[model samples]
Target chain A: MAHDTTIQTAGHDEHHHESPVVFGFWVYLMTDCIIFGTLFATFAVLRNQFNGGPNGHQLFEIGGLALETALLLISSITYGFGMIAAHKNEINKVIVWLGITFLLGLGFVGLEVKEFIGLIHEGAGPDRSAFLSAFFTLVSTHGLHVSFGLLWILTLMVQLAGTKTIPERMMSKLTCLSLFWHFLDIVWICVFTYVYLASMI
Target chain B: MSEHNTTSSGESHGSVSSYIIGFVLAVILTVLSFAIVVTHSLSPSATILTLSLLAIIQVVVHLHYFLHMGGHSEHRWNNICFVFTIGFVSIVIIGTLFVMNNAAVQMMSR
Candidate 1:
């Protein structure tokens, strides 16, 4: 098939250029930025509307957020390493780095779920106040994205394991996922700063 | 996508050093933002300003090292689209805040 030859060319060629597919992915990410920006605006507007409920300073645990931040940041770099390995045509190393990235991402989502459950148990659920509603909507949206990214990493790992060589289509897919994974980390930085740290101060 | 391969070369994929640099800088900024709040080393306004500045810087760093977006010809369209989107996003966020906060102020005063 023509597809098979394209994959062979992409696999064997050095300094292969990214196809238009990557730019298309970037366009999608840009729209995602708008979605997050609107959410951030909503959170900003409602942050002070505690409705007689506990505020962020009282509800957020800095240590836990720091741990989540560390997990996510580390995972971003590990995914970068995976991309580098992919470029070097080391399929096994790429899979290994991706596996590590998956675990770290899972850890991040786990801590987020724990925090959400704990908050709900303590009556700080989204229903409690406008502030909490905005908080839950904004933060959980990011959490959901991470969960999806974890699923993506898993799917890719399974696909990579079955193949001896990364096909052109596969490499492009990996590149898009790498961008997404790093993009999430970037969003988390904003979340940590504005939502958590700013609230603390 | 196939047309793109024939027309343009790919952007830089990033190196290990670039990744490490981005990670270290991100960690530093994160710790600094957290520390500024925890230690209460600055006034409230100053802390917010500093955190916002740090976050912006960290974002740029990630865009550069991780995303491999740069101010080069190869990335011209990507940069243009990014700036265009960011402009609209700023309008959305800042405009909403300005209007809503003003409305809140007026309503609360009564």
Candidate 2:
């Protein structure tokens, strides 16, 4: 469904053309951003409402979170590398970099699940207090996105591997995924500072 | 997003140096926020404000470098979407805080 404006502009430019689908993806991403923003606000309001339960300073392990943060941050750039490879139409390099990105993303989700389970085991489950509920909801929502991103990476990899050449449809999806992955990194930056770092200091 | 972005023959490519620069800046920003929090080297309010400011800066850096959010060729929608998102985000966040905080005060005082 190429818009008339898209074709005319794309033809005139001779290079640096973009499909209209990315605009739709941008709209999708903004809605996602709104959801996250609301979640952050919810967390902010409830962060101090421990209700005689353990608070962030007690539950947050800054060291572990920092490591998790590093993994996700690095993974975003690794996915960026995959995007570059995808553009260059290099199947092997794209697979290698995307494989690395998948590992890092998988590692991030693992650490998050481990931390959530650990907290639950210690009687600090979401039901423990308002603060705990907000914390779990916000962080787990992020983890869920990462999990989905992992699936997207796998699907793209399998598709690329079978096709033996990069297709435009797959490339568009890859570009959107690249944007999604990087957007998640930015959100994680906020979580690391506003939630974890603020609670600690 | 990459610092040096080029598209020819209907393919988009980014420079290695661009990715490296964004990565290094992000890492540095993350470490700085951590160090400031762990060390307790400033007043509590100052620390929070400083960390928040740094986070905002890092967001901008990622948008510019990694997301390529600027006015790229044939990408007017990207900029428009960014402005729209920011407006909506500010409203959602600020509105939530204002309403929730007020409700808490009224309920608790009663």
TM-score of model 2's chain A, to 2 decimals?
Answer: 0.91
lDDT measured at residue B58 in model 2 versus the true structure, 0 to 100: 93
Error of 1 at A64 (Å): 0.1
Lowest lDDT sum, 10 consecutive residues, model 1 chain B, at B1-10
After superposition, the stretches of candidate 2 with alpha carbons farther than 4 Å from their true spots are A1-16, B8-13, B108-110
Worst 10 contiguous positions by lDDT, candidate 2 chain A: A1-10
C-alpha lDDT of candidate 1 relative to the true structure: 0.87
Tell me, by lDDT, which candidate is best. 1
lDDT by residue (A47-124, candidate 2, tens digit) is 898889998898899889988999999998999888776666778899899999999999999999999999999999
DockQ of each: 0.48, 0.49
| Model 1 chain A worst lDDT window (10 residues) | A1-10
The CAPRI-style docking tier of model 1 reads acceptable
Give the poorly placed runs of model 1, Cα more than 4 Å off: A1-15, B1-10
Backbone clash total for model 1 is: 0
